[model samples]
Target: LSEIYPRNLMRKTAKMGGLPSPSEFVKLVNSSASQGDIQIDHVEVIAPIYEKWPPDSHTRIFLDSSNKTDEPVYAREVLSNFLSRAWRHHATDAEIDQKLALFAKIRPKCDDFQEAMVEVLATVLSSPKFLYLVPPGRAKRSGKSGDGNRLAAWELATRLSVFLWCSTPDDELLELSARGRLNDRDVLVSQVKRMLADPRSRRFSRHFVRQWLGMQLLDFLQVDRKAFRQFNPSLKEAMQEEPIAFFDEVLKHNHSVLDFIHADYTMTNERLARHYGLKDVYGNDFRRVELDSTHRRGGLLTQAGLLAMNSDGK
Candidate 1:
């Protein structure tokens, strides 16, 4: 599920700490954990080792057979085979063919075929078709299995992933779609509940309050520095986080929405509690503190987030 980055690839190379043969490159790219093993599925040309072959080195060019003086006829063949294996299920023959043709078109202009294939690989990575999960074919009145109109398995998986995890489908979800088993309501509900239970669902609170109070525009508010010297960067960060934490607690604990107005408890870390004149609270952990009538800190209005956002001066 993780995107492969050049830095991580380089780190793996360093960990190996030796001149890498083509087999080593194959091992790195085709490793199960990296993008999953491709060897069992098909033969693949591992992307060129950048350090072993400079971007346009003569040796690299010679490998692709574009040098005409000395070239490997199997270079393009190997690259095409590798790409097809790596992207086996996701890309169609037409798509792979298009990419191979791109390699052919660029090979004459470039010094080496490996370099040309690098350009092709870069294009494949950046292509919208590769990066985005697009459902096959145009929208139709009826879907597979004679449903008059319903979301396809892939589309449903995408919606469920974004709603629950706020991200794209992982291998499990994608595999479910590939097997055509993501349509059950019970299964979808289970996934939704699981995702909501995850810590990342705190995003819900952040998005809700930001829109509810229209505080988004306040980013441009110019504070009078001399008037509000107490408002430091740490205080501002604490203010934003306090309400978000509180709202998350409410959701996690299934507390009534009315608690937002009537509950005496507020969340605060040491720094925030000190700013709010709450005594004896220490450390950077948020804990709920019950408010007394004398404190007048019953709800979010008394919280640092809203207070800071609403404060004009003094």
Candidate 2:
């Protein structure tokens, strides 16, 4: 929708039937279409878009320092700060010293500080500190263990974030864990709620549903394309998206898990509705459409994508 028609609807209307052609636009200009010019002397680009100067990104690299000119000191400070976030553990002074030693060795060989640090950062990324999230012995989320060992708060927070968001813990989650509140049932519940509300949680639905349902099998199996008249590459993509979309809808609405097998409404879009002989829905956007018994469709089994994947390719 953002592609076809943006929210602002700038110089566009449903009746105009898409952007005016170059010649049509020129004709409108001559015919005196509403003429207005608002001169913009400057613009303030926002964060998560354009970083503020001395940009947060710049500050992230070049932190405040008592000995700013002491490159080695500042480099040590930066590396320690980065290790805490990337490794999800505090960097011991010894560890930082070792890394700074490498940085010092590399810095003199490079054109500049930034270029030299890239090699150090690459080394950190390849290290186990970045490569793996090793759950300690008996530090699982359930906390029920014969040995009675429990996960640290940060450990639990990292586990939750990775499982749900398939990413590192955000600031709030890490803070909660640092405070040793993550394991508390009430705090855990609140954090779970917050994580669910986060957009990142969508990753959980995509990955979990795809794997659990074996949706990737769709890619390997050749559909009987000729027999299925409407099953082209674009439609094939839509078919693959259907189950994931359905799963996402069920998750977002907190609908019953049984909806995978039986739901009154199935998600469809212009392409899917046409393929399903579903009426009225128009546009690329997928949406829920109410289905009755006559449609002979409600669940995963009846989907064209799955059915084709299951077919003996003709």
* Clashes per candidate (backbone, < 3 Å): 4, 0
Give the Å error, residue 244, model 1. 2.0
Indicate which candidate wins on lDDT: 2
lDDT of 2: 0.73
For all candidates in order, the CA lDDT equals 0.60, 0.73
| Candidate 2: regions farther than 4 A off | 1-68, 138-151
* RMSD (Cα, Å) of model 1: 14.0
Shift in Å, residue 264, candidate 1:
2.5
Tens digit of lDDT per residue, candidate 1, span 1-314?
23332232453332213444443433333212112334245445556646665454444323454434433345445444444323323343566667767777777877665556666777756766445555535433333473322336667766666655555565677677667666777777676676678776676667776777766544545567798776655566667777777877887788889878867788887667877788878766678887767776656776666765676645
Candidate 2, 1-314: lDDT as tens digits = 01122233355433213554342221111111112334447545344444456767577766778967888877888898887767765566877888898998887777777667767877888887677887666332443552222236667887898889988788898787766778789999888888888889989988987788788777876767678665665577778888878887888788997877877889887777887888998866678999988886687778877787776657
Rate residue 273 of model 2 by lDDT.
85
Residue 185, model 2: Cα distance from true site in angstroms:
1.1
